[model samples]
Target: MKKSLVILITILLSAVIYGCSSSSEAENADNNTEDKPTLTLGQTNWTSTIVPTQIVKQILEDMGYNVEVQDAELGAVYTGLSTADVDIFMDSWSPQQDQYMEEYSDSIERISASYEDAGAGMVVPEYMEDINDVGDLKGREDIVNNEILAISEADPAMEDLQDIIDAYDLDMEMVNSSEGAMLAAAEAKIEEQEPVVLYGWEPHSMFQQLDLKILTNEKVPEIYGDTSIHVTVQNGLQEKAPEAYNFLSNWSISIDDMTEMITKIDDGQNSEDVAQTWIENNQDEIDNMKSN
Candidate 1:
C-alpha cells in the first residue's frame, strides 16, 4: 500500500508541473499580443510645421494612438527617424531636404506628401507699389534705406536669397533674426505704416494679418524647385501602428487652410483651440482621410 501511494503522488506532481509551464507560456503570449505600440512624431520650429503637427496629433489621437511630439532640428529629425527614435515626421521639405533624404533613405521610409507649393520669397507691404519684382528693388534703393529685410535664423532660403542679391547686385541688406523678432519688427513697421520688406513664406499666420505681397522674380523659381513637404515614418512604423501610419499617409492640408489656423494662433488663440476649430470646420476632409 505504501509503494502504491508513493507512485500516485509522483504522477500528480508531474502533471501539476506541466500544467504550470503551459499556463506560463500562454500568459506570456497573451501579454505580447496585448502590447500597444507607442509612436513618436518630429516637428520643426516653424509656425507652418507647428499648426500641422498639432492637427496631425489630434487625428492620430482620435484613432487611438499613443503619440509623442519631439521638437527637433531639421537634420536631427531625419537622423531620429532613421534610427527609429521618431516614428513619424510631417515636415520634410524636399529638394531643400534632399541631402538628408538621400543619406537616410536606407533606414527611413518616405510616406506621403504633406503640402505642395510652399513658396518662399522676399515680401513687401502692399503700399510699396513701386517694387513689383525683385529687379525693381535696385532702382528704389534710396526709398528703402534702413528698410530692414527680416529673415528667420539660419534659414536655408537665406542662401538662395544671397545668391539672388549677388547675382542682381541689389543694395538692400538682409537682416537675420528669430521668426518672432522678425515678425515683431514687421508688425511694428506695418502698424506705423512704415515701409518694410521681409522674407516671408506661405502657410504662415503673417499672410492673414499682414497686407504684404510676395515680390515676383525671374531668378527664383516659382515653386521653389518642385519641393513639397512630405510625411515620413520609421522603417517598421507601418507594421507596428498600421492605423496611425494609414492616417498619416492620407494627411494633407491646403495652404489656405493652414494660413487661417496660423492666423488664429497668432492672434492669441491657444494651439489646441486653433487645431480643434480647424478640425471642426474641415470635418469632411478629415473624415474622408480617416475613413480611407
Candidate 2:
C-alpha cells in the first residue's frame, strides 16, 4: 500500500511540474511577442506600392518586428501617416507628393529615396509615329477614341491627368481602370499595332515588356517629370523604431531589379516568394540596408 501511494504521489508531482513548465513557457512566449515592436505600414493600392511594401515588411519581420500592412488610397495614406495610424510608406514620389508632405509636414517625415529619377507621365507605343507630343493629341482625339487610359481614380496620377487635360485643353477623356486592366488594354492595342496613350512610370514591368515612349509637351508644366520615390514614415518613427528607421534610411533597389521583380509578379508569381528570392539573392545589399 505504501509503495503504491508513493508512486502515485511521484507521478502527480511530475505531472504538476510538467504542467507548470508548459504554462511558464507559454507565458514567456507571450512576453517575447509583446516585447517586439509592432509596426503598421500604409500601402497604397498600386502594384508598385505593393511590391516594395511587402519587401520591407518581410525584412522587418526578419529583424524581429511585428509588422502589419494597411491598404488605403494615396490621400488616406497621408492622413494615416499624419495621425500616426500608419507607421511607414515605402513609395512616396518626391515633388509630385510634395503637396501631401507640405500638408502633413508636422506629423510625417521623409527618410530617403528608395529609387531616384523615376520617370512618370503619359506614354504611347513606339508605333505611334505622328502622335509624339501631348499637344499633338489635341486635335487627333479620334485616333484613340478620344480616350486616355489611366489607373484607378484613387490614384493621384488621375488627378494630375485631369489637370493636364484642363491645362492643355485636350478634348480627350481620361478612362479610369486598374493597372492590370489598363496594361491588358495597352497590350491588346500593342499587339494590333494600334495607338494607345496611357499613364506610365519607370520601375515598372510595362516598360520592360512593351516598347513605349513617354510624351512631353512644353505647353503645360511637367507634373510627372523625373521624381524620386521616397521612404516616408510618421514623425516619431526614428525614435520609436530606431532599427527599422536605420534600415529604411539605407533602403534602395535598382530600377532594373525592381522591374524584373514586377515582371515576375505580373506573370503570376507570389509577391512574398519573389521578395524572399530577391532577399536571398542579394544578401549583401539587404545586410547593408539592415545596417544603416
Candidate 3:
C-alpha cells in the first residue's frame, strides 16, 4: 500500500511538471509572434501625419511585428530617421517639406510613395472666387481678418509662408495656432459662407469635409509645393527588417480613400479603429502588398 501511494504521488508530480512546461512553451510561442524586429515609427504631431503613421503601425502590429511611434516636430522626425532613432516615416511631403528633407538626404532612404501628388499650401473656401491664387490674399487682408490660420509655431512651413508673404508684400498676419484651432476657425467661416484661408494640405479630411480649394502656389511653384508624400526609412531599415521594409515599399493608398479615412477619423473616431476597419475593407490592397 505504501509503495502504491508513493508511485501515485510521483505520477501526479510528473504530470504537473509537464503541464507547466507545455504552458510555458505556449506562452513563449505567443510572445514570439510579436517578438523582435520591432519597428520605430517617427511622426509629426499632425492629424494627416498621425493617421498614416498609425495605420502602418497597426498593420505591422497585426503582422506580428512590434511598433513604437515617437511624435515630435517635423524637423525632429527627420532627425530621428537620420540618426536611425526611427525606422520609418510614411509621410514625407516633398517640395512642401524639401527644406526638412534637405538636411537628411544623405542619411535617409526613401522607400515608397505614400501618396503620389498629394496637395499642400494655402487653402481657401471655393466660394472665395477671387482668391484663386496664394497672392490673391495679399490685398484682401480685411476679408480674411488679416490673419492666416497656421499650424503650430514649430512648423518649418511657417518660414516658407513668411517668405511667401514677404515675397508678395502681403499685409496679412499668420496666426500661429494649433491645427484644431485653425480647423475650428475654418469651420465657423465656412458655416457663414465667409472667406477664410488656412494652411492646407491634401490627403487630409478637410477636402472631404469642406468646400475648399487649394490656393495655387503660382508665386513659387518650384520652391513651394508639389506632391509625393513619400515613405522614408532609416538607411539600414531594409537590412535590419526586410519584412517591414518590403511591406512599406509595396504600400499605396488612393487620395480619395485617404481623405475619406481622414474625414472619419476627424469625426471623433479612434484612429486605430478607423485604420483597422480600413484594413478589413481593403484587405485586397493590403494582401497584395504583402505578397509583393
Candidate 4:
C-alpha cells in the first residue's frame, strides 16, 4: 500500500511541475510580444500611398501592435527610413523609386515585393469611352475645357505629363493643383456625367471611387511600364520586431485589391472602418499569410 501511495505522489508532483513550467513559458512569450516597439510607417504626400499605408497601420494595430503613419515629402520619407526613423512603407513605385532606394541600400532593406505591377496616365471616367488614348485629348478642347487636371506643380507626374503633352502636341493646358483639388474636380465631373481628365495611376483609390479609364500613351510607353512596388524596412527590423516583420513580408496585394480599399476611403468611409472591414472579410487569408 505504501509503495502505491509513493508512486501516486510522484505522478502528482510531476504533473504540478509540468503545469508550472508551461504557464511560466506562456507568460514569458506574452511579455516578449508586448515588448515590441511601436511601429512607425512613412508615406509621401501622394494620395495613393495614404489609404494603403493606413490599411497596414490598422491591421497592425488590430493585431495588438502600436502603429502610426508620417506623411511627408517623398525625399524626406525615404531619407527617414534610411536613418531608421521609420519602420516600413509599402507604397514604393519602383523603377521611379529604384534610384532613390539605391542611395539607401545599406540602411534600408527591400524586404518584400508588395505589388508586382503599376502604371500611371491621364485618366477619365469610363463614360469617356469615346476617347481612347492620350492623343485623343488633342482635339477635344471643348470637352476637357482645354485643361488637364494635375497634381501639385512639384510632383514628378507633372513633368511626365508635360512630356506627354509635348509629345502629343496636346491642346490641353496642365492645371497643376493639389491631389485633393484634382480628385475634387474629378468628383464633380463624375457626378455631372461630364468628361474630365486628371493625372492618375494604378493602385489609387480614385480608380475605385470612379469608373475611370487610363488613356494609353503609345508615344511614351517607356515612361510607364510594369514597376515592382515593395515593402521596405529599416535594417534590422526583423531582429527588432520579428512577428510584425514576418507578417509584412508575405502581405502581397494586387493593384485591383488596393484600388478597392482606397476607393472605400475616398468615398468618405473612415480609413479604420475600411481596413477593419477588409480584415474581417479576409481574416482567413490574412491568417494564412501570417501562418508558419
The global C-alpha lDDT for each of the candidates, from Candidate 1 onward, is 0.78, 0.87, 0.83, 0.80
TM-score of each: 0.80, 0.85, 0.85, 0.77
Report the C-alpha lDDT of model 1 over 137-240, residue by residue, as the tens digit. Answer: 87676565735466654556677767767666887778888788888888888898877778887768776588888878776663345658888888888788
Which residue pairs in candidate 1 collide? none
> Which parts of model 3 are misplaced by more than 4 Å?
1-35
TM-score, structure 1 vs. true? 0.80
Which stretches of candidate 4 lie above 4 Å from their native place?
A: 1-34, 44-47, 62-64, 139-145, 189-195
Best by lDDT: 2
Q: Which candidate do you rate higher for lDDT, 1 or 4?
A: 4
TM-score of 3: 0.85
For residue 32, model 4's alpha carbon misses the true position, in angstroms, by: 2.4
Ranking of all predicted structures according to TM-score, beginning with the best and ending with the worst: 2, 3, 1, 4
lDDT of 4 by residue, 75-143 (tens): 777888988888888777776677668998889888788788687888889998778788777777678
RMSD of each: 6.8, 3.7, 3.4, 5.0
Model 1 off-target regions past 4 Å? Answer: 1-34, 146-148, 222-227
Clashing pairs in 2: none
| Superior by TM-score: candidate 1 or candidate 2 | 2
Best by TM-score: 2
Lowest-lDDT window of 10 residues in candidate 2? 217-226
Whole-model lDDT, model 1: 0.78
